[model samples]
Target: MIQRRQGGFTLIEVLIALLVLAIGLLGMASLSMTSLQSNQGAYLRGQASMLAYDYVERMRGNSAQALLATSPYVISLTSGSTRNNPDCRTKTVGCSASELANQDIFDWWGNLQAAIPGSGVTVTKANTNEYQVVISWTESDAQQHSTGSQTQNFTLRVNL
Candidate 1:
């Protein structure tokens, strides 16, 4: 009589191993996706901040014609600001609004649609001829597991 040797892994053992592996793989996948998304958000936010600061720099070096304009809300880009992309003709001051608008920074911001896509900038003129350049964009903080946004500002108080 040949005896049957019961030397094999039970069904329960196989199932349990599979379950643990699946859970581990799922956790790793989720972590990878989250990391990718965070990187993208950070990149966008950085670009937005640089754009805002670029505007502030332009304003600091602004020409008297644009700065001293009667209009409190100086939005030259709305007008024929990009009509002329003249050379850096300013000897000791900023370029005219027209020239400034033709700069790369304005071009990067797309159009005067009144808002930056996936972001927003508020160029507020404050006391003592100061300018508050605020840039905002959405991002997720993994530690908090919260979905929200943030605002970064580059304050430039003109020497008036």
Candidate 2:
């Protein structure tokens, strides 16, 4: 009598195939997690860059006070302090340069604190028409893990 061979895979073959599939899925999951973390870090960095640029523009608009040695433009805020309102937002009346500077700084600082975690900013005069805007903030979890630095800084030089 002739016997017919089964046309199905053995139990061991099925188990091996399942094991390979599981490993591939695990690898894909790890890759996706890393991509998400990197994207978050990039987003935070972009926010920091924009904040620094905004601060520079504020100083440029109030160039008079910005050039003064003891100008409000040359200020630093890192402790997340609550600033008082500058009270110069009325469109009917005009504000002096110094008052405008105060308003700008107050508004900018408030924005920084609200937008960035552990944020700090410093504006220093480099020359007669050149100034440096330095902004610092805490990095996201992925950045901290990869770079070993908890904080990051962005600097901009403006000439008014």
Candidate 3:
């Protein structure tokens, strides 16, 4: 008597194949998520860097105020609630150096908040004509598994 051979994969073979495919799919998904998070972190860092550079340039423009020890250029991370006089955005003819600095800080802080939530900026005087711009932001998702803290800081030092 001749026995007919099975023409398809066995149940065990099918199950093994499915398990392998599932693992591959899961790995792809995990890689995609990690790539997305990394991209977002990079984007945030770029924004922070640009903001710091922009502020530094503004300080350079107002070198007189920037060099002053009591100038707004030497500021801590505050809520930036000071209303700018003469509305620097519209009238740039007679705004004082301090007013321009205030306007710059206000606009920069606003942009920082809008671009990255929970972001803060601190400008510190390092020397007579040198300053450091420290930009801090929370990377809650990217650094969730890290040790210490989830906050990231970017510092840019400039000289007027």
Candidate 4:
């Protein structure tokens, strides 16, 4: 009788296959991690935008009151990783309620430390007899964050 050879993979072949699979899995895992982080960043931004809108709506609703109030409404603010004056207790001056309301709203949106409002713009041709509310926050590297403020504006139209 003739002896027949068994048709099967050798131990070395199986080990090599497993090693390749492991490497591929590692690569895939890293890619997934990066994608998750990007998604999280986008979610945070969306929340920030919603926060901005909330403040804008409040300003719109309280246009007459804000315009006639003795002081401005101070929203809250933060600069990415920078430390902030939460209450502005150190100084006699603080942001008005309407001025920084969007920022304060931003603070409530996520884990970010603060949401600061940048003094910029007015009610341009976009809306007549409306005071524009502008809010901004730093969200990147500290050095570049100042220039990289995430801003949103809304108009509070009042019949003056």
Candidate 5:
């Protein structure tokens, strides 16, 4: 008597293969998520850098007040602080150095908040001609194991 042999995967073998594929797909999905979070963090960092540089440029433009012993540009702003947008643009004679600094800060803070929500800023005089600007914000895409959203900061030091 001759017996017929089947040369195909068994039910158990197919099920095991499918399980492995599912696990691999899950791993790929997890990697994609991590990549997205890293990209978002990087984008926020870039925005912070741009904002800091913008402030630096503003300070440069108003170097008279920016280089003062007690610079008007030196300020610390909380995330919830209400900003005042002075209409320095309407001044034909041009605003004072302090007024320019205030307007600059107002515009910078507004851009920072618009770009990255829940953001705060601090500008400190590091030296007679140097300043340190720090931009801080909360990242919503932080790890799931953390107690809350992670706070990230970008600092830029400039010398005029």
Candidate 6:
């Protein structure tokens, strides 16, 4: 009688193949999770950029107050700070430049809080017509397994 070799994979071979497949699947899953986290971080960064730009534009629109000796737009706000919306929005005749500046700050802070909680903002006059805007927030990073959150900052300098 002639001995013939088996054509199919052995049990051990099948088990090894399954193990490799499972490892590959787990790697893919981990990769997907990392991608999602990166995307979320990018999204938060984008939001911060937009918020900074919006605040800059608000200052640019009210350049007179923004460049005043005591500018209302020049402010430093801590996290979770609240501002009362001025009566300018309700008045039909509109409001003064200072009032508008106050309203702008109120609206911007409200929007910022809504978009990113626990965010802090600062706007400082750098020159006669230049200003620096800084927005900061904390983000929990996936890679930081123990030390906790990382702080992110978005800074923009504008000439109005």
The TM-score leader among the candidates is 5
Preferred candidate (TM-score higher): 1 or 3: 3
The global C-alpha lDDT for each of the candidates, from Candidate 1 onward, is: 0.53, 0.80, 0.80, 0.46, 0.87, 0.88
Question: Can you list the residue pairs that collide in candidate 1?
Answer: 61-94
By summed lDDT, which 10 consecutive residues of candidate 4 come out lowest?
117-126
lDDT of 2 by residue, 50-158 (tens): 8888888888788778888777788777765677776886756878888888889888888888777678888888778788888887654553346454667888887
Show where candidate 4 strays beyond 4 Å: 65-76, 79-160
- Residue-wise C-alpha lDDT for candidate 6, range 1-77, written one tens digit per residue: 99998789889999999999999999999788778877888988899999999998998899888888778888999
* Model 6 lDDT-worst window of ten: 139-148
- Backbone collisions counted per model: 1, 0, 0, 16, 0, 0
Return whichever of 3 and 5 wins on lDDT.
Answer: 5
What is the per-residue lDDT of model 5 for residues 1-160, given as tens digits with 9 covering 90 to 100? 9999988998999999999999999989888877888899999999999989989998898899889998889999988887787879987988877888889888888888899888899999978997899999988554673446788999998789
lDDT for each residue of candidate 3 in 1-160, tens digit (9 for 90 to 100): 9999878988999999999999999989878877888898899999999888888888888888888878787877744434444477678476778887888777777788888777777888878988888988877464454433377899998778
Q: What is the lDDT of candidate 6?
A: 0.88
Candidate 5 lDDT: 0.87
Q: What is the C-alpha RMSD of each candidate to the true structure, in Å?
A: 6.5, 2.9, 2.8, 8.8, 2.1, 2.1
lDDT of 5 at 153: 92
TM-score versus the correct structure, for each prediction: 0.60, 0.80, 0.85, 0.47, 0.89, 0.87
> Could you tell which candidate, 3 or 5, scores higher by TM-score?
5
Q: Write the per-residue lDDT of candidate 1 for residues 18-132, one digit (tens) a residue.
A: 9999999999988997798778766765665566655655555554423553423233232223333344444367665655544534543454223445455455555545555
lDDT of 4 by residue, 88-113 (tens): 33446865554354344434433323
Query: Candidate 3 regions off by >4 Å?
Result: 78-86, 90-93, 141-149
